[model samples]
Target: MRHRVSGSRLNMPHSQRVALMKNLARELFEHGTIVTTVTKAKELRPFVESIITRAKKATTITQELGTKSTGSPEAMELKSRNLALRREINRNFNDRKLVKKICDEVAVKYLTRNGGYTRIVKLGMRRGDASEMAVLQLVDSEEKKETK
Candidate 1:
């Protein structure tokens, strides 16, 4: 019936789909944006959001704990705490770095705002595959200015 089915399969197997999503996420983090099919963008939104939300929560916890500020006795301790948090969120260094960047640079820039951390702009269709294309980017003025 496919009634309760969630998430698009993109016709790929389970393991391949996970791998594809992970790679796309890594690339998106590294580039601060990416252009892909609209379907992929939709799927990637929640996946990426979960990571950002975790980072945000971690940041909030550190802030509340008064541990991560500069020129403090607990600064080194907070650094270790952040490192552990990063490792928990993403096992690899590249992914960890991306998460940290997203948390410190991207998320902080939008702290005053609510959710909807990303935007997907449709770019018509691809020439060869005729697939729908869209650009997904972080919702921040600095990124907009940098790209423009």
Candidate 2:
């Protein structure tokens, strides 16, 4: 009856599905916006949000530990937390620059926001494939407004 099952298969095998999600997510982060199929956007929302959340947590931890004395136990703990989050994120995002952007800049931008990092806007259908299309973008922040 299709109950309790989660995540769209996206007509691809497990490996391919993971790869697609990774690429979609990376592109979305890099460009701040992307247009893809609606189904894919829905599937990607949670994936991207989780990474942003992780980055946010790491940023908080670093800030809290910054004032504390280095070489202390808390400092070591903060270092480990940052490293773990980076390792987890690096698996999907191969680019070092993008990873840095998320950890250093993006995380700081989202520090006050609890969640809901990405937005989805339906864009009708693709003419070639008739696929329902959507635009997925990072929610705008004050910093972004100034940069434009």
Candidate 3:
């Protein structure tokens, strides 16, 4: 009867699953990479991509708006108008800055890649529960020699 179930449950409850995803996403953003299970890495790919896509779109919008605003004589007319426009642009810039930093510096490191941003190296099995173990990492670091 599990006909329409789309995503792996990983035997976790809904809230915990969401929290885990969020935490993983945050870690990936902060570290530009992570080591996790294959299943988790596969799941995190689309989730992280969506965030990066939104950030790229936001940056595009900011660029377009900045170009439009600065091209008009009205932008130079009144101080208040200029201030308002600057405020709007600044808000957009701030939003895009965080996105750009994460997307450009972190995500772009994997730019040539079409997909498969992560890799999974099987690590045998867990001791307690005997579940399969794997190490999931960002693909860009694949060639970097492991220190230990």
Candidate 4:
């Protein structure tokens, strides 16, 4: 039956689902938060988190190897790995600037921690069709306040 179906389809075809996730992700990265239906937010969480994880991994790879001008085997390998990860991340979003922002800013913000990069807060229901709503946001801002 519905056993291994995985991920909510959200009543959209494959292409629409991909596009919706991409747009939602772009908005989330640009604004640090977004509001959407709870079901959509649930689907968006893992998709967005995976991108963040890739960005973080790429950053870690560069940091680990530093900027050695020498063509050392280890440094070269790490550089290639980092590039591949960046390319993988780049293919998902339409905005190159947004991708850079994610890799440079958002990823670095979460480097000290592991996973759980996003938070979802329930906001009751929409008045129209009575669909449940929620605010999906990055958790780093709260952490920033605490560090100050």
Local distance difference test, candidate 3: 0.59
Candidate 4's TM-score reads 0.92
lDDT per residue, candidate 2, 9-103, as tens digits? 99999999999999999998888999999999999999999999988887888787888798899889888988888878887887778888898
Question: TM per model?
Answer: 0.77, 0.92, 0.59, 0.92
Clashing pairs in 4: none
Return the top candidate by lDDT.
4
- lDDT against the true structure, per candidate, is 0.77, 0.89, 0.59, 0.90
Clashing pairs in 2: none
Off by over 4 Å in 3: 62-67, 71-100, 107-114, 141-148
Q: Which digits, one per residue and each the tens of the lDDT, describe model 3 over residues 1-148? A: 7899777887899878777877777777667567667677667677766655444444444444565666566434433443444344334334445454654465545544556655567787678887666665555644465643
| Candidate 4 Cα deviation (angstroms), residue 47 | 0.5
Q: Model 4: per-residue lDDT, tens digit, 47-148?
A: 999999999999999788786654898888999998898888889985678778888899998897788999999999899999999999999655668899
lDDT of 3 at 61: 43
Order the candidates by lDDT, highest first: 4, 2, 1, 3
Which regions of candidate 1 are displaced past 4 Å?
67-85, 92-94, 141-148
Residue pairs that clash (backbone atoms under 3 angstroms), model 1? none
Candidate 4: worst 10 consecutive residues by lDDT? 62-71
**Poorest lDDT segment (10 consecutive residues) of candidate 3:** 85-94
